[model samples]
Target: MKVVPSRSSEWVGPVTSQKRASAIIEIDRVSQVFQTSARKDHLALSNISLTIEEGAFVSILGPSGCGKSTLLYIVGGFVSPTSGAAKIKGQAITGPGPDRGPVFQEFALFPWKTVLGNVMYGPRQQGVRAAEAEAQSRALIEMVGLKGYESFYPKELSGGMKQRVALARTLAYHPEVLLMDEPFGALDAHTRTRLQNDLLNIWERDRKTVLFVTHSVDEAVFLSDKVVMMSKSPGCIREVIDIDLPRPRRRNELLLDPRYQKYIVNIERMFDESDEAGAPS
Candidate 1:
């Protein structure tokens, strides 16, 4: 894996902040191996290490089959790494917990539930009172632009609307970290762009540590504080590119900006180079 030089000297890998506790998520030498009956063994990740600071938005950028979703699932505690650890707030993640909320590509809202009920699900499950859960869910629903549609069922909503509900549901319980595996991947181009802006706006308000996994370089550059590139197959951090663009990023404005184009091109070049290097003679 290629190690990119730090853009800011003060921002070292381990000492990203003046205080060690500032690191909200720590992924140390994480590796995942699948031992299926059909295959002898498949190593999906190899020595993947990353440290994300508090309130920072980071993206894991790679081609398909690079274990991007696998890494995200590992951090979310849905899947355990073969030999390494994923920690948040100094505690090892052994299994799925409310502390880390996950938003998957498939909006996994219960079909029988209304939008309000779906958002309230997590908080209520955690033992919050009915009134309190509804209040929390209502606020999140509004934040994700689904305020008046609280009565609508998942079956009645569009893909974008469902994704909004999914996001609100994930954010209802105030998680310290958000793990999203291509949450907007299936949406149409226009809807995807709108949701991206909405997500950033929500992130600005909430300021949670977000780890987003996407294959699009443009999406990563537009949303991330840093774009972490991964190698093919046994995925590892190939490079970490710093995005120097200002926040409150808009799609049209950034799409026109030269710097944004440069970052996107640079990342694309890195992936192209990696693919060429990995190709057989």
Candidate 2:
């Protein structure tokens, strides 16, 4: 078994590691305010600034309604921030582009399309030749462990299988950053764990920059290079902890590792503290 040192600290700004990679996504003092049905402005995120390095897997962990998904949406260019800005590779994000791909909790697969057809959609829309698109899609489907299920429709597959196809579809476009918003939240515990392991396997192959949002502390620590903790509703960064676990992490090994256990305990402690501090006196 391999061991690596872990560090925890209050996140003030960009990580100051000696080997800090270039920032692929920059969220500068971004804040989002939405007008609720009651006609009052509700602050979803408040002055949230974050920097995600290229090819890094970072997870945003927070309590429910902490604006984790809102922050992700800003980076994905799906929703504009009420204030501040989000940039990709130093360019302001005005709208959705191929550089960012999102996989949501909902399978979001086309019911009419087969697994192969769904995966091939992105490349096809990008104008790749049909033969080439099909070839690429087939490879992706296989890579996601859905090899023989190529012709199956979304309705015919299980929850885990549908999520695999959704992931393959996103990967087909060759996006630089993968913005996953609770992609496995809808599945059963067993299936979620399987997909989580599969996701890491596929991610290890390319190391694409990934921003994952999850409520699970263990899941965050298990999959991320760094876990960003956020405050309750009207979210703000509370801390950013570096997870220095060894690569090709096996769940069984990590479950028993002291360092891995420490990470989870410390994070859960922080959340408990946050909750206590927010409680009404």
Candidate 3:
């Protein structure tokens, strides 16, 4: 049956309701803890409350040991929370599921498998056939700027290239949301900038919900629509900075923007206020 197009509903989803897709994921007053060897408890995240809209590019930025990664793991379903809830599309997250794709900083690719094979591994486990999965994997690899290196193993690729393979692997599964844990943190400055631009291109084309964790203020500002800043020592969200910068932002142009520096300074002040010792201006 052929459906008729309506003038009012050019955007996807229900005609009357256009909220830019339901809040794809939500973290409500959640806390995470791990038991110390001394038999005491250590809180990692403390009451992290946030909502990520579908197709939005969001970044979580904080200092070292602020539980930024722990929060990301909870959203990715790799770890359970100690209190409160993490929900995806109104459903509570129980454990790891294919609906969310996680790209780690270490670029965990299989040494034995070729790049193409590694990317196809996820779908193959989900019962997808070899031929189709391979084709899709190749497309993704090429999309991530690793076209001709499909036959190379993880050991044969550079640090940046290995990360590309890991990201390709995550995309091949066709996940609804992408959880990136400092994917570019391991790369040198030059390679990191290149990958950051590449990732922005991919995000524009695919438009998937993404929650990226990064320590670089510039990176967080460049790649995100909103930057969620967390406090240190039993982390809690301190601020959320909305990036009014234009889309498809170039690295040089974005860095040169005065607003960029302003936002960075504001985030720094937030951290200072959260801590007992505020940095002298």
Best candidate according to TM-score: 2
Query: Global lDDT for candidate 2?
Result: 0.90
Using lDDT as the yardstick, the better of models 1 and 3 is 1
Model 3 C-alpha lDDT per residue in residues 112-135, reported as the tens digit of each score: 999999999999998999999988
Candidate with better TM-score, 2 vs 3? 2
- Give the worst 10-residue stretch by lDDT in candidate 1: 9-18
Task: Kindly list the per-residue Cα lDDT of model 1 for residues 153-228, writing each as its tens digit.
Answer: 9999999999999999999887888999999999999999999999998887757888999998899999988888
Please identify model 2 stretches exceeding 4 Å from their true place: 1-21
For each candidate, what is the lDDT? 0.86, 0.90, 0.84
Which candidate comes out best when scored by lDDT? 2
Clashes per model (N, Cα, C within 3 A): 0, 0, 0
Model 1 Cα displacement at 273 (Å)?
0.8
Ten-residue stretch with the least lDDT total in model 3: 9-18
**Residue-wise lDDT of candidate 2 within 1-281, one digit each (tens)?**
11123443432234543332478888899999999999999899999878788888999999889999999999999999999999998999999998999999997999999999999999999999999999999999999999999999999999999999999999999999999999999999999999999999999888899999999999999999889999976788898888878888999999999988988998999899999999999
Quote the lDDT for 276 in model 2. 95
Residue 10, candidate 3: C-alpha displacement in angstroms: 31
What stretches of model 3 exceed 4 Å from their correct place? 1-21, 273-281
